[model samples]
Target: MAFPRSTCLLLLLASFLLTPLEGHTFNVMDYGAIGNGRTDDSEAFMKAWSDVCKASASPTFLVPGDRRFLINPVVFEGRCRSKKIKFKVDGTITAPSEPSKWKCINKQCHSWISFKHVDGLVISGSGTIDGNAEKWWKQGRVTGARPNALVVARSNNVQLHDLSFKDNPHMHVVFHHCDGVKISHISIDAPEDSPNTDGIHLKETASVIIEHCTIGTGDDCISLVDGSTHIDMRHIKCGPGHGISIGSLGKFGLSETVEYIHVKDAQFTGTTNGVRIKTWQGGRGHARNMIFEKIRSSDSEYPIIIDQFYCDHTECHDKPNAVEIRNISYIDVKGTSKKETAVKIACSDTVPCRDIFIQNINLIYDQSGKQASAYCKNVINGYYHGVVRPNISCLQNDKLP
Candidate 1:
């Protein structure tokens, strides 16, 4: 059989086009990204993400092991074609040490790596995201101009595990407006004096579960802000930071609500506070149906505190409206408090906290040798059980004056 050259070429092209498209692994090194730790690999990363984002099948974007990648501020934004994508970071990702080089003009630019509008994204790696923050810390001012190591915003069905973040300039990881996020087996470390270096911060997010994580940072180990709901945290070890907190919320005097939060089986060592809920004096909304149980604290201050009048500066004055807090419970919380007053429930006089329950709580001051005490005001329907310190006499008999 003799075939003409043009006909043979057409048949070959048809055969190639009919072949099935296979999944690919886009390596950053293949796209002109030198993993020498000094060269800027931002463009390579962007190109890799673009290729993987358009993959028809589930593909992997890999950062190979044993190499260090220096990436400036980059955003991996997507309405990706793939239904699922895997990002395997097997090497170190380092940020620029100099703050001036960051050139961050606004808050959005203050993130080293950001993922937006990504769905079904799995980020797991045995690698490190190093935010060489010692130089920024020396500048001595915690500003929004500094970049956070990672930010996952407007994303859904995200799972991040087995990763490490160190020396972050700001909060290590932030989940903003994200849903169905699960994070486990992660480690975050920062100096105790690294200002505003919160470990994990959630805002406007829902259905998040964070477990089996060890976090040590300067600010709150875990902070849930406005519009966050159904958050569960378990088996977390926190140290040298402000402990788990909710509702440093409504700061702008806006209407905000945080509900259905449960934090159990957690331990805090040398933290400033444990299981705290703080809100500004003039705010609207509610913090309800929250539980903190089986918490073991060591050398912590204000082991259980609800401050409706949370003003950080001297110029802030008391306001009338406050966030309504109700149906909150703290059970089996035993700790050594650094302050003499272990329990302070300073609720708002206007709205007042209701349906508060405390059980099996035993907090003792370590150094003072004085017994820990409880202070309550403008609270009602309070119940105490099993060795309550400082005597919840003020809250006895549902008394409201």
Candidate 2:
């Protein structure tokens, strides 16, 4: 068969164009990352991340299995050339033991592993991130600041799954100022006495989903702070910590808003508090449209609590202003409370909690001799249905002037 030279050249070009481009896989070891658990692998990780960030094709930065790589504080930054990136970690990544060795370049540098300003990022693995944080915990009380184990900040469409975190000095995993984030199949563990080790903390984030996670730590299993909205959490197992809280908001006289949050299908055991919303006294803003449903608790203190005057100090100064909490509902929550008061709604006098609804609550004191109770103050438009302990009549028949 004879063909013109021009026709043949065109055909060749077409074939080349139709071929699929090969994607790059940047291995950490190839970039001089030693997984011996002793050597610092921070530079190697950064080098591999830099390479992948600039790759034209969607690339993967891989940490191989069965090795422990000691990493210092590092940031994986974005505005990357690649539209999608996979951060695969099948091995362990550990922090340094000495707290003084941690470099304090900025507030973001306090995290051991941080992903910032990245879009379409996927962090998935069956591995662990161990913050050797006993020493840091002891030092943090004096220093008044401690590092987080993992943080995803200013990223969109990020997914984190199948990872384990342990012994964080402060918050274990944080999603800060991110949108469209999904976290699932994760496990977080720390000692019950480990100070301020929240399992997962979300702040200034929106459209987030957290599901199928098991978390036990010193602080809240999941904490949604101010500027967080449209969050959904389900199928979570929380214990030995403060169970799933919203706020401590409106702190330092700041105006904070949290809304459209939903939590369901959670179990709490031996927790200090379950499903709580707390706000400082002298602050403004509002928390609204929140729902907690199908929560089961065992020997938990304050299974449901809304403390508008949330002060930890013993000699706290009295303040008039408060965060307006409204349109909150708790449904199908059955539990055994260690404390005599199973439900406490202590709203502020100036800005009362309103439209609070409770249905099908069956909380009882752990001690069979003691009766379950509910305390309410400065709460309005509250509704109750089916088996409310201590009775809603107390609120309905109040004659206070």
Candidate 3:
């Protein structure tokens, strides 16, 4: 019974005061030259993100190097319980092509990087957040007003890395109702005839992990905004734009139920199609167990699509009765099309698209550059066999047949 060296130094000082270190790295150009590039320096980078995101730390917040800063939507106020704000951008944070210099103070602006009720946030860097956005997409082509780039609400354990975004007036990135999120080695772009440039927009998110990204857009290079679920998309390099979708949900009847997803080794170019899922027409719920592997396509259209009566805008005056797609699968999806006609599936009239699967795929379409046809109302089952468009016969609406 040999105790007492001052009671073992008071139990080693109570385990070093309840062990918790590593969280704090701040350096906005060493707090000077204030990130030049026409600086407001966003109140000295929100006072170094409220001083090391509530110090007690050693990791996160080092937007280093050749700076060119300007930001808005900057309400990164602290008290995140822990995990601390970690933004390690090594240069280039440009985002003020005058959205009225990010006006706020009750105009309710937020997002050039945002987070609500934060969690262990860690935005990585190979540096570049440039939303120069070609004069706000030329004023959204006469003031349509597009907007969205790096927004994470109702936060969770979020992590972004090796960044690079270009010309984004809208939907370059957004994850609302966030859960465990992780996006990697990014490279995004716009101008596939830029309209509503989308590339990674997962609203009402759950568990997500989008990897090795590269998207170019006008729309839907990842638009599943409506109560998402555990998603895992890999090696994606989607298109000139639009593909990899699962929605276009109707109004606010929002009951979205997308299932466990796994899209692998992807690649699509000039894409208007290739693994798509659209829903509207009095939308209720249900998008089941999904899986698309080894996907590859070019000059796409019907590269693999599913439309549950998705009517882009206006024209879906509520028409769902038998809606509910199930266990979907596409394997060995290979590319090289664009003379047109590869694969397209459309459904409704009582929700036609049902349990489907495509195997050992190889699609190459082009009978006259741009092929896609399908208008199957209440689509049932299919083992789909390819090749159409050589003196076309039935390639259906949105048109070619």
* Best candidate according to TM-score: 2
Error of 1 at 209 (Å): 0.4
Residue by residue across 1-401, what tens digits does model 2's lDDT show?
89999999999999878654437789999999999999999999999998888876678999999999998889898988877888999999998888877655574346778899999999999889999899987765787678888999999999999999999889999999999999999999999989999999999999999999999999999999989999999999999999999998988899999999999999999999989999998889999999999999889998999998788778767798889999999889987999998888888888988988887788889858466888888778877776566565424422323
The digit string of per-residue lDDT tens for model 3 on 1-401 reads 99879999989999877754455466866565367667667677777666665666545667777777876656664455466567788788877787666655466443566666777787778877777777776666464444576777888888887788777777878888889999988888878877777888887788899999888888778877567888899998887887888776644455566777888998888787777877766667788788998887876766777777666665446565523777787778866666444655666667566667655666545544333333333445544434322222232221213
Question: TM-score order of candidates, best first?
Answer: 2, 1, 3
Q: Would you give me the overall lDDT of model 1?
A: 0.88
Which regions in candidate 2 have their CA more than 4 angstroms from the true location?
1-22, 106-109, 367-370, 393-401
Which pairs of residues collide in model 1? none
TM-score, each model? Answer: 0.92, 0.92, 0.34
Q: What RMSD, rounded to one decimal, does every model reach? A: 4.1, 3.6, 17.4
- Cα lDDT computed for each candidate against the true fold: 0.88, 0.88, 0.71
Quote the lDDT for 179 in model 2: 91
The true-versus-predicted C-alpha distance at residue 202 of model 3, in Å, is: 1.2
